[model samples]
Target: MMRRRTTLLASCTALALALGATACGGGGPVTAGGGDKALSGQTVTVAGVWSGSEQKNFQKVLEAFSEKTGAKTQFVSTGDNVSTVVGSKIEGGNAPDVVMVPQVGVLKQFAEKGWLKPLSKTTRQSVDANYANVWKTYGSVDGTLYGLYFKAAHKSTVWYSPDALAQAGVKPPTTYDQMLKAGHTVSDSGLAAFSVAGQDGWTLTDWFENIYLSQAGPEKYDALAAHRLKWTDVSVVRALTTLGKLFKDGQLIAGGQKEALNTDFPGSVEKVFGPEPEAGMVYEGDFVAGVAKDQFGRTIGQDANFFPFPAVDGGEAPVVSGGDAAVVLKDGKNQKAATRLLEYLATPEAAAVWAEAGGFLSPNKNLDLASYGDDVTRATAKSLVDAGDSVRFDMSDQAPAAFGGTKGAGEWKLLQDFLRDPSDPKATAAGLEAAAAKAYRG
Candidate 1:
């Protein structure tokens, strides 16, 4: 996870996925050989929204790639609005050689516009050897692979403090009803039942997606992602109402919707596990473990731990995943170097580097799980792989950006409104449906 973890990324075969420590050297303009990866000295420009420590770690990985290929890699921080910055760059004919795209919807949009270059044959084979078919489908648009998923996150985990739960005499819930029961118990114990990242609208969307996917099933999830299912549908209403139970009296949550709305992602976790804990649990991806460890200086798997999001409606267990995808742009001045970078990223070695760094997970099945830094990290990675065919990608990510990734104009805004006052699930569903209609139209 890039800390922000607004994430998804991915490819290569025959060439070893294992790598040694990155070597040091200088890179500049040099002639390319006719052989594959003919990149000797070429500057490949890569852009992403990652910053702070997350960006620094990724830079280490890029530096490692540079060591092996003699290609100078420049990393650009795209801020929070990667779409706006990258779009402007593309329009101005300055698209970076390789860009880390966060959502599958946007990647497909890029592919449709012919702005992306397909992965080379070796890169394609590498992807095939490393990731599952579902992951392969994520990078493919119209039967052509346009992106590689590099960093994946398990969204179904619920982080909690055992001491707090024990104080409330509550065990981790295994079902939605059981969760609400536990919530009531915690509230009775005068502690928060949940800490939400309402300020960042994306987190609210994730809340809806997880419950919707776990309860309503994948077919419905796909329908919603494709915009074929209206948000006002019965299943949608049911999902919202179920979540509403936790938000109802403001007694179960650390901060009411108002406070939650003002709290950022990391702040959301801080409310739960901070020195003076205000909440007993937080529902987020595995990245929260990294945030807890890094920002708040807490010991994960001890002070904080996670469990699978409980089931709802007796449906299948939930395993929602999202990550950053790397795409080679057609406008990339150094396509060969960019392709080589993708080859390196697809290997287990690259995933291992980031996984050991914390707050990150890779879907690379071939990577040895032992490389993970801790038991919690290994558990998160293993959870995703064990999900197999039952896994579902982030629903909003698969939708049009206007409906998925937009901060204030689409699902994000609608979900925030729903969080503020979840009294009317039907109204919330209608609002979401109305927004989806407008977003899908153009």
Candidate 2:
């Protein structure tokens, strides 16, 4: 979907509001309580939307940093709506030393407001050596670097239940046309063809983006993300028209448009793997495997399989993705400690911790492929790297937060409407262009 789990931040003022208020957080430098390392009394606080098992797994990486640097670290799970929660923290003069921004849009927005801390010289050198220029590009705003993409997800994948596909007597579609044919065949076999999470407009947006990228190529995709190309452009029209082929047909979707609109991401996945499976396939990132495994207790490669989202324009498989970047604040409570954390994350060793945990991917090109959790993840990682420059970040996350991140607003609203009834591509285009224009005007 969008940046399924992402980050956000706000601006900060130099003045500390009171007579003698230090920058960012309330505490002084917090080093090891037992006084173990060279630096004493320094604890760096990290805030993000990560929690539960993801939080528990990430703790291992944090502990690794603590062991290596003797700098105590506390991770604050911000829960859902990171922008709202983290923005409040910053405004309240308690911004964490380092904040994770999930998408380039929020990272750039935070940097644009001068809230992020620039990477230290030592940390910079480590990231430079470990990551590719493309991954690095997402972390930098203009010419200054502020974030590091630590975790990544490959969005250009379609998950299918092999038994369902076989019963339908159709293989996964190799081409866009073949995809539609497979859908029809699956329907003919008395199964819904697609399980779309229409409740989350971003998933629908992703569908359009994948089709557009394959059909229009990367240049147009980038232009659109930068608003260099208007939503009213023929490229967008073509993509929407192509989307219409499936979305317009109610029988093709599980429970039709109404049910699709009500089905959330997890529910959409459940449609394929649940007891009374509703659909044969769902298009999502590799993370969905974790969803299947954890929620339904299904064996991924056995019960479910995936292929790169089939090419729509007779082009290569479209691979769109989302990733999390670690952006340190310039006025962080403990710059040294935060820098140490970033340095650890930049290394291949830390990546391997989460890698083996499954459902995690790193854009660090230096990391070995074997570090991935499973054969499926390895293949997905390879496809991601192989896509190379062909890869594009999720489009909505690149748009204004009001339009992209906010629920019941802008693209999310209009696209929900479009999916409800997609015959009128021109109207949908006009609505999209209008909302985008208003949001971008800010």
Candidate 3:
């Protein structure tokens, strides 16, 4: 079976299905001439929320594209709140040719405002043939394709320390009941079994989504995304109930709920390899292993390993991982070149460069695993693409802005509260449903 791994920041993909590398030389603008007419004097200004490693990789791709098309590409990296910056640019009529934002909900809004351009026939055919269902499903606003997918980072898989589990004589669980059994085994040894920075509010939603994946399956989730399913549905309630049980079972650290609300992405992994009380398992993506290695000097395969979030007994396995994608603005000045970049990004060379640089899973299925930097990342990428089973995008990321905002955070708080006492699962879920319904109305 293909081994699984998680991507960085569960919210990263939720924030867009979210992209490259190279050196550069001064060049003139190019045209879209294919054969002998090669694109020679075109320039595409890319506005993206990429900096540091993301920028480094992106430059490589831009340089490569420049080399191929003789097009001069300029990049402007935005701060984390790219939405605000992008909004102002759109209003000021200074928007770049291309911008990468997380969450399709924002893309839909842009499409509604006529900020994004419709795809050309070529771009449409390319995306249809190569991109996965997740993006195609979310990339469209109405029936038109407003976004093109490039790279993805997975979120739903659980990260753990296999060596640590073996040392504690605990096996990885295959079902919810089995997970509880393993948790008891590890807790008996006085070590943390599950570690999460629950203070982030989004973290709780990750847990909630996992439960939903196991209980309601992908059909219900798809309906949820389309706003057809009620949050108070019995299946949704069951998922919430399940999450509450896991929280109260003493499987996680004592202050997990509190810690989740306050801690950042790497905190949970640190607990697993930190100073005083090292934990054995932390549910996170492959990037968390990098954090553990950087902060605690732990190697991934040596000190930690990951597994799929187990099958739900007789139910089908839920494909869970989170990643980001690229989108071009329709009415923007550089719409043509932006669309070209989107198509270029789906190539194997670009995909490999992205995977090697940032350890991100590129959405391009044509990428060769042999080109990956390491076996772990290669394996992770393979698992993400090969997932033929049901796969749902991240919950908060898939939901509307209202559901992903304070209201959603409040719902998670309620889940935590209900986990502290499961007697009111029905009431808690109903309340959440009411909140979601109210949010949808606005």
lDDT (Cα, tens digit) per residue for candidate 1, span 1-442: 3421111112222343322222311121111121233455689999997888889888877866766667788999998677788889988999899989888888888888888998877667767766788988989999998888998889999999888899999898898888878987887898888898988999988888889998899998989888898998999999999888877657877778788889889998998888888888999898888888888888888888998998898987789999899999898899877877887787766776776666688888766677688898888899898776577889888878888898886899988888888999999889888888987887
Model 2 Cα lDDT, one tens digit per residue, 1-442: 1221110000001111110122322121112122135334679899887776678778877775666556678999976466677778888878788887776777878888888877766556656666657776777888888888888889989999999999988887778889888888898898899999999887888898889999998899999988888999998999999998888886689999889899999999999988889999998888888888877988878898897898887776788988888988765777767866776576555676777777687876555677775788888888887766567898888887776777788888888998899888888888888888888887
TM-score list, all predictions:
0.91, 0.89, 0.83
Q: Model 2, residue 69: what's the lDDT? A: 56
**Candidate 2 Cα outliers beyond 4 Å, as residue runs:** 1-41
Best by TM-score: 1
Position 44, candidate 3: lDDT: 85
Candidate 2's C-alpha lDDT?
Answer: 0.77
TM-score of 1: 0.91
Q: In model 1, how large is the Cα lDDT of residue 151?
A: 88
Q: lDDT per prediction?
A: 0.81, 0.77, 0.64
Candidate 3: tens digits of C-alpha lDDT, residues 319-347? 66555557777546656567667766644
For candidate 3, the per-residue lDDT at 280 reads 77
Candidate 3 deviant stretches above 4 angstroms: 1-43, 50-52, 70-82, 274-277, 293-297, 405-423
